[model samples]
Each structure stands twice: as C-alpha cells, then as structure tokens.
Target: MMFKTDKQTLTDLNVLDWNSASLLRFFDHTLTLGGRDQLYNYLMHPLTTIEEIVERQETIAYLSTVNVSKLFDKYMMVDLERYLNKPAAPSVKNRTSYFLDTISFNFFSLSAQREQLLVRQSVREIAMLFTALQDIVAEAKSSGKAVGLLRIYADFFSANASVFDKEEMRQVGRGKSWRLTTHKYNYLFRGKRRPQVQELFNMIYTLDALTAVAKMWNEGGLCFPRVNTNDTAAALLRIEGLYNLALDNPVKNDIHIPSAQNIWFLTGANMTGKSTLLKSIGICIHLAHVGFPVPAQSMETILFKGLMTSINLLDNIGSGYSHFYAEVMRLKTMGEIMTVDNPVVIMLDEIFKGTNYQDAYEATLNFINSISGIESSLFFVSTHITDLGEIVGMDSCVALKHLETKADPKQGAIFTYKLLDGIATEKLGMWFLNRESVFETFRAVQPRKSSS
Candidate 1:
C-alpha cells in the first residue's frame, strides 16, 4: 500500500499520514469489540479477491483510519453465508466440504473412511429428519393440537421424549432404509449405523453445532471475533472529525471532499491536499464505518472489509526493478486480493511516477478502468500528469482539485502550499528539474552505454 502525505498530523493515519498518538487506543478498542483472534481472520478476508491494484491502494488508506487491535463488525457475503450455515458459492463448495470434513474428523474418533462416511450419513439423516419434522409440524398446526418439542418427536417416531422429543428425532433414522437415503447414506456405512435408542442426542448435537457455525462461520469467518478496543467512543469521535471535514469540503474547484468510491484518477497542483485529502477521507471512513464517530460532527456510510495501499512502495532505491514491470507485478498481486463486489479503499500517489510518460499514462489508464466497477470505502490518488486527468474526464473525477498558486513574478516563485481552485498549470517544484539530471539537463550527450 502507498503511504499517506501528512502535512498536519504526525499520528498513525499519516503513513505518509499515520498519526500514531491515538493508534494504540484505536487498536485496543477494536480488540475489545471484535473478540479474540478474530483480527487475523478479518485481515485475511480481503485476500479472497483483490480485483485490481487501485482498490488495494484505497484499502491501505482506509486501514490507516482504523484501530488494528480493535475489530470492525462488518461481515462480507461469503462470511454471512458461512455464519448462516448456508452454502458458499458453488465454486468454493469442494473446499468448504474439505474443511468441514477435516473439522468433523479431528473433533471425532472415526477412521479416515469412517469419518467421511459418518459425515455423509449424518448430513443425510439430518436432511431427512428436517423434512419429517416439517411435515409433523404442519399436521399438528392444521389440527386443533399445538405440539411441544417432545410430543412432536414422539408422534413422528416411536422413540421420543419423556422430557423432550429430541432423542426421537435420531431414532427415526434407524428405521429409514439406508438404501432409500441417497443424500447421507455414506455416513451410515462410515460409522455404526445401528438404530441407537438415544437418537436425539446425536441429532441435537449435530444440529446445534451446524446452527452455531452459520452464525460464527468456520473456525474464523462463521462467527465474529471478540472486540477488545479499550475506548470505542474516543476512536469514534476522531472518525467523526473527518466526516466534519468531508461535509465541510464540497467541491474540488471549491474544494469540498465529497463521498466517493473506488479507483479515483486524481490530478492537481502539489499543495492541493491531493495527498492530504486522501488521508482525510480515509480517516473519516475508517471512523464512520467501524461504528466510531466520524471526523465531521455528523457522518454517513456503509461498512467495509479492510484497507490496503500501493502509494509509497514506489520510493524504493530505484525500485531495483523496471518501473512498468514492477507496477504490473504489484497490480497483479493486488488483483488477487481485491474483490470488485465488496468495498476496498485504495490510494495511488503518482502511480508510474517512475516510468516514461507513455507507459505511465497507459498503466494509469488501465488501472482506473479496472476498478471503476467495484464498490469502495475510498480511492485517493495524486498526480502532476494532466493527460490522465483530462482523458479520465475531470467532472467525473473523485479527487481532482488543484493547488492554484499565485507567482510573485518579482521575487522568484515562493510556494504558499495553500490549495486553491481549478487545476494548476505550473507547479513551482520545477526548479528542482535537474535534481537527477535526466539528460534533459545540459548536454544532449546520451549516457554512454558500453559496446561489447
């Protein structure tokens, strides 16, 4: 993830903008609320699909907003399915079943073949039992009778409750011809498939675990981890402050940072808060969605999975890799984790800042197009490249405000660092032109490449 550009606060949100002052407190709050070890699963959930690099950047920017130690309570669809004990997408069924098998096997004492069969059988029995119970429920409801738990089980099968009909639910399975049950027949052969008297015990146990898993999801996602943030209210308040900024700032030409979604193609003068704006919005969102207060006195938003970045990883000692090459690889890695359907907050600072103009422009174009379709928490990017802004269409731009500077024509160019309206035509940083003599400097002499 790219770091933030903090001109004001030196806290943790300023990794270009992480303000560390309230960082620990923020994490403590998350931990307090999200529960134990749930943080690990929360972090890994985003890896399910990184649709593009741009979302990854925004994702990082969003991360700078939250307390890592504290847990955010938002749940993704897949997580919801798992928690509800519904099937995940068909693409992931085999994996889910494998995981289920492992859990069931480890928690029980069956041999490998036995384990597989037992799970299958249990699932079949459960399904049959479900249908039978439904039928019984209907009959009782239609008649003048109201069936209690035990009475229903006893009515459906001979073996039911003196206390509760719970045991009877299992006994009915013994009467079911294994050959007739196609759904869970394997389980019977896998384990002891005799008609046990305490059928309700097994039924209740399996049903309870299954139901709990849907609420909690797997060992990780099925259920929410505990939240342990030390101070939820304080962290929420800081978040509120950013909302205040968002509500306060309205237009780029006028410079009000409005609510926006993923992969923004930003271009502006150096001091326009392009970078700072990115963090401000990021902080605001992290605060608002996590149920913390926003920067603004009032806040509004939907919760997100997590945040990621690809902004500052650029300042490597010449990248030790080709600019376009590295950019491509980084984006590929990001796409693996960023999902288009879910929200990811990304921030890119002068992406391709190291590549030739042509390649940089092309890469940026592709990046923007890729994430334009995904939902997001925030997407902030900064650049001096005008074509990117123009080609992208500024009116549709997310963070396109410029830092309009007034030149003191008489006393050299003094930078105010104050942001202004409209896109900037000239950034005063030009004086540093020859800082790294790119043969654009004195002498048309090309760097002498050695001949073999």
Candidate 2:
C-alpha cells in the first residue's frame, strides 16, 4: 500500500515537465512573503514538478495582511526613489531631473527631515526680502503643501524671468519654495530681492542644460524578468522511456545538463529532435537569462545579452541578392551584433544548406570558426552532414552531442530522441526508406557480378 501510494504520487508529479518539476527551490525567501502568489509561481516552477502554481489564488490572497500592505507601500516608495536614481525609459536628462523632483515630494510628505529642508530656507529668505508681504510665503511654507507652493513661485519667476537667469527666476528654481522670510524679519534689513536669490537662480539655470542627459532615462530600453541563480527552476519539456514525447513507463528523472561551456553540435538521424533539442535549449536559455522561470523542472544558466536564431533565414527578394548572398548577409549581421558588453547567444540550424556539399561544409566551418572565439557567445548548429562534428570538434571550440533512434517492432522505426554524446547512432531516413519495399527491385539487382 505504501509503495502504491508513492507510485501514485510520482505519477501525479510526472504530469509536469521534468524541467518544470525540478525548480522546487526558489521560493524559500522572506522577501517572497509580500508578492506571495506571484513569487510562488515564479519560484515553484523552477524547483519542483508543479505546473498549476497559478491556480493557487487562495494561497496568495491569504498572505496579504495589514502588515504586508504596509510593507508593500514601503516597497513602492523605495522603488520610486530607486527608479529616479537608476536608468529607465525615455532616457532624457531634464525628464530625469523632473523625476527626481517628483520623488522628492514622496520624501517630503513622508519625512519631517525632507519637509523642513524643502521649504524652510526659501520661506525665510522670501519673508525677509518682502517684509510687508512676508505672511504669504510663510503660510505657504508652514502648510504641508510645499511642492505646490514651489510651483507657484516657479510660475511667478517665469513671468519676470528676463535674460533667463534673472534673480527672481533663479531663486524660485534653486531655493524653490525655501527662500522666504517674514515681514517682521525683513523690516529690520533692507534690500532689492537679495543677492542670494541671484545665486539660487544661477543654480537652477543649469537644470535645463542637463535636459539632454535626463532623456536617456525616459527612453526605455529592453525590460526582462530577473531569475535567481540559487533558485530551483522547471523544464519546459522532457521525454522519458522516451521518444521526443516520452513513454508510458520510463526512467523518471530530472536530468540536469551540467556546466556545459562550449556550443553543442547536435547530429542525429533524419527525424530525431536534434533540431527540437536545439530549439528547446534556445528558448529555455532565453527565458531563463531574462529572469523568467523556464518551462523546465529546473535550470541554472548564465545570463547573456540576447538569443539569436539563423533558423528562419528568408531569401532576399532581389536587390540583386542570391540565396547564398542573403544567408551570408544574415550571418554577417548576427556576427556584427555581438560586441564587448552586449554579447549574443546564437542558434544556427545549419551553417550552409543552400550550396553544394563541399562548399556548404566549408562555409559551415568558417562561420563556426569566426564566431567561436568570443567567451560570451554560444552557437548550436544541427546537421545531417556526417563530417561536421569532426570538422568543428577538431578545433576544440565545439562540443558534440547526438540523438538515438530505435526500431520498435510494434511502433516500427521510433526515434528515442535522447541527447547522447558522440556522433548520431543511425542514419534514420535512409534506413527506413530502404525497408519500405519501395527499393525492393534496386536491392534485388544488387550489382549482379560486374558486367564483364
């Protein structure tokens, strides 16, 4: 009974992909307590054989307590500040300065320290300068609406801002709402708007000069999810007892690809998932590197600049370009995209399928050679060309793996579709075609003893 129960549990778990089941480790963090459900799905997908993490809505909502709510508010405010300081979309300089000003309001409203600094200096100075009308600036300062009051001062300065850097305009921008003083204080000391106002105005004038720099943050770039390396991840797909789809009773496992550094050259019989395996690794690597939990049971992969594919190469439609020319252009473009900081993970299905055998192999060799030296880049190319592994592995720059095919009497020719080291074990399509009786006459003739 215990054995049956355990078998049932494994059966239930096997319903999830091997990779997906493996990622059972990422969720054990104090931080995940807030974004509980989302975090759970994110972490659980990589650590264990669980596919239905999203259906656990009840689990997530239960964790959102009042204390958690408060923590979320703190997180948002902190993130707001971090956003202002860090680079972000629309990458504009003045816009970013504006974002800093926007963030300053959050600080001012939440903390006494910020409020005092924001309005005190300018309010005291303004009151002293306009002794008879000091109460207006002082009241504005005392009220917990300093940001709005600063806007009013900015507007007033705009109206009288001659030469763009006039004292009135500069003070509003630099001291903002802080340079104000009371009528009582100003009555004892006399001056025309004050010399410090001119200095403050000068300081604010530079803010526009920085508008260009601020734009960089405003123009957003690529955004991707973050994956924790220490977290367990799931697989998108796996096969067991396995043809590509897997078998009913097979060795249940979480086969983890080890610290594989070099590019894997997958060669196999005609129908094997040499290409499928290539695509699987390509897609999973992309998703994982960008910080999304993969469709695997678990994953541990290095983050890279981007994943590129030469699989869907389309021929150029005539700006005077041949098929080979178009392919070369595409390969060249892929090569050019890789630079020092922004590296690439490229997938090349076949080096050159457009030309004759010798030329195709030669092109394939050179392409791999050119791309192999970069430490940050990886390329996987699938081929029916037998000598490809020999050509590429000779350089020690390529790693080799192949798929296996089996002849199941009931299933006929079945591809196990397993990833194995060394060259492919069979020439699948050739052998199957020979068995079909379609070549019966050809086999019967058998070159009948040399025509003497």
Which candidate has the highest TM-score of all? 2
lDDT (10s digit) by residue, model 2, range 255-308: 233223356576877667655565555545533432333334444444345556
Clashes of each: 99, 76
lDDT score of residue 415 within candidate 1: 46
RMSD of each: 16.9, 20.1
Off by over 4 Å in 2: 1-260, 318-321, 408-412, 435-452
lDDT of each: 0.41, 0.43
Worst 10 residues of 2 by lDDT: 1-10
lDDT of 2 at 83: 26
* Backbone collision tally, model 2: 76
TM-score of 2: 0.43
Q: Give the CA lDDT, 0 to 100, for residue 158 in model 1.
A: 41
Number of the predicted model whose lDDT against the real structure is largest: 2
